[model samples]
Target chain A: MIHFDQVSKRYQSGHEALRNVSFRLAAGEMAFLTGHSGAGKTTLLRLVALVERASRGQVLIGGQNLNRLAHRKIPYFRRNIGLVFQDHRLLPERTVFDNVALPLVIAGARHQEIARRVRAALDKVGLLGKERLHPLTLSGGEQQRVGIARAVVNKPPILLADEPTGNLDPELSREIMGLFGSFSNFGVTVLIATHDIELIQRMNTRTLVLSKGCLVDD
Target chain B: MRAKATTPHFERGPRFQLRAWLLRHLQTLFSALGELTRSPLGTAMTAGVIGIALALPAGLYVFLDNVQAVGQNWDGKVEISLFLKDQIDDEAASRFALSLHKRSELRHVQLITRAEALEEYRQLSGFAEALNAFEQENPLPALVLVEPTLRYAQPEAIKGLVAELGRLPAVELAQFDLEWLQRLHAIIHTLKRGVVVLAALLALGVLLIVGNTIRLGIENRRAEIEIIQLVGATDAFIRRPFLYTGFCFGLLGALMAWLLVEGGLWLVRGPLAELASLYQANFLLASLGLRASLVLCLMGALLGLAGSWLAVRRHLRGIEVG
Candidate 1:
């Protein structure tokens, strides 16, 4: 579950990334965030990830107010939320398995547990056979799958993606969107930030549109 | 295929937590080692630089240790030379030397008759031709050399003994160069202090060297660090590998320092032994023994850890998932 209480983020350079934006998503709900390039979608995801704090209002996840979270507690808080990027953000030098196992490793999971979970996650992404292969060797769509596998490796309750299908072809984008749909179906709250209106229409999910740092439509 | 993907959470006991913590550290340790091995030349160069820095101080310490050992052995060199009165004949002086030898404070006493004294001066002073001009009547006084026992070998004790001997019958002057002995000790003390200062400076240098290397490593892995941070890796987890890298650098550097010092001492030992033999001293060069090498290695490892910690603290703050 994610909730924003009229959050506003004003950068030091006088740029407002988000302005008085408020939204709430129940557990297991999936939603798409649509906005122009400079709109506040990425900033919204960042606030959820606690990469940046809201300047004016409270951002809550699972009823926990993130604005009050201590600096040292941020890592533990983030463990419950998975984030995916457009570029995959996989360590190019590492194997697909290693890339996926990172989150579990960060969680201090046992070796056996990590191996099992990582394999399961990889299997879900159809990357079971490419575990030993490095991310760079994989195709663009496959690389994005590796990133998705990494995001859900720990079975985080909430998954956030920022333009995850940006670099993929239309078919691959559809496939990636389907992967997100499956995660949501399994009770993982998903918020995908993208400007791909056609893909949003095709996915037929709840959409929140932003323009000039304000929620224009939802 | 709808898989039941509900998250399962379990509470672990402290023992399990500790084991998992240790396992993670072990993984990071080996991974850090592998990273160093990946760039063998660069690692070697960095480690070599640290080795040279550490060796300067380590070598000086071993050198000081040997010098102190030589100083201890030469406690007998603090001898008191007693010159007999001109009226005292050779037999009486020899008898006096024999009597002096009975004292517990004296280790040895040898009588140098006037003729023997003249002959020693003629051979050593380069005044053999000048000494022949006074061949009929030798001008040198009969002498007695008295070496104090080890327990009474301190400058103060020797000075006390010299004063006591000065008052003895048939002794014109109890001559001992106490100033020279004191000067030797002063020189050794100053050199020891100098070595300590140099060691401190070089230790600081080692810290900086390791710190800078770790900083560069963090910079190069900036992207990976950001990714890990975004994925909820704690500062401690991200820092573990870099700390290990520094530790390996320090440990390897210490090994290299030991080799450099031992190899240097080995090469000079032969010449040093020859020199000692020429001086009639049974002295051998002392190498950096096992205990000292172990300490050197420990210091290197600690410095590496500290340097990497400092670098990580400073730079990790700047790389906040940007």
Candidate 2:
């Protein structure tokens, strides 16, 4: 579950990213956050990632207040949250398997467990046969799938994807959205931040829309 | 497919946790080693700097050790020379010389009365006819020649002996040195201090060299590091490989320095031996013993580890998950 209570974020340059935004998602629920380019969706997600602190907030994930988390605890707190970037930030030099297994390696997983989890993740993304290939050799959709596999490799309880389908074709975007649907089916809460209203309409899921530093509709 | 249906919660026992801990460290250690081997030239250059820095001090210490050893073996340079007062008669000086023969330090004590002293002085001064003019009274004092055993002939020990003899009622002045021995000791002391200072400065230089290298390495890997930090890698996890790289550099540098110092001493030993032979000495060059080489290697590795630690502590904060 994620909760943002009266959260506001203002950059040091006097630009307000978010203003008094409050939201709550029940445990095991999935939803989409829709907003314009500068509507502060990324800032909200960044607050969840603990990458940036809110100017005034009580952002809570699983009932733990992230605003009160120490800097030293940030990494461990991230262990439970899976993040997928818009550009598929997989290390280009690494093989698909290494890219996926990175989180487990950081967690000091046993080699056998790492192999099993990584293979399972690759299989889920339908890239099991391309584990040895580098990320650059893959198509954009495939590269993003690799990124998804990496995000889910650790089986993090919460998944946050920022514009997961931004660079894909319509069919590929549908496929990627379908991947989120699959995870949501089993009670893994997923929050996808995107502005594509058609995709949101096609998925028929809960949507929270932001406009001009405020939540305009839900 | 339901995600939790196919995936049971991944949990581990304590034993598995321990094994994971061990394997992770081994992987990082080998990975760091691989990074260095990927660029042989760069690693060699860094290690070479450390090697030269370490060798300067180690070689100086080895050289100084040999100098003192050789100096210790020079026994025949000088011995105790006791000058009796002019008031002492020939019989009294002879009695004192006989008493000196009872001491273990004095190997041979020769007594020369005033008559014998004047006669030797007449020959050496080339005043035989002028000496005949001093028939009224011989102005030369009685002399005692005391040859000390080799064991007690060290400058410090001889000085102690000279002090003891000067307190004698009949002795006027005590001579225990070749005069050059005191000056030689002062020079050796000064050189020892110089070597210590040089070693300290070189050690500091080694730290800076290693620390700078690690800092550059951190900068070069900035992107990878940010990615690592993003994916829940702790700072310690990210720093592990760099620390190992520094340690490897230090270790290899120490080995190279040992080879350099030993080879250098080997080259000089031939010439040094001949020179010592010319002086009728049985001196051979000294090399770093196994214990000393082990110490050098340990010190090199520690310096490397310390340098990397310092660099990481200072720069890791600047590289937050930006």
Each prediction's total of clashing residue pairs, residues at least 3 apart in sequence or on different chains, is 0, 0
Two-chain DockQ for each candidate model: 0.40, 0.31
DockQ of 1: 0.40
Which one wins on TM-score? 1
Q: Which 10 consecutive positions of candidate 2 chain A have the poorest summed lDDT?
A: A180-189
Candidate 2: tens digits of C-alpha lDDT, residues A60-144: 9888898789888788778777899899888887899999999988988777889999999999999999999999999999999
Q: Candidate 1 has which clashing residue pairs, if any?
A: none
lDDT of 1 by residue, A1-218 (tens): 79999999999999999999998998899999999999989989999999999999999888889888999888877888888999889999988989999988888888788899999999998989999999889999999999999988888889999999899999999999999999999989999999888999977899999999999998
Q: After TM-score superposition, what is the CA distance of residue A190 in candidate 1 from its true location, in Å? A: 0.6
- Please state what fraction of the native interface contacts candidate 2 reproduces: 0.37
The candidates score, on chain A by TM-score, as follows 0.99, 0.98
TM-score of chain B of each: 0.82, 0.71
Which clashing pairs does model 2 show? none
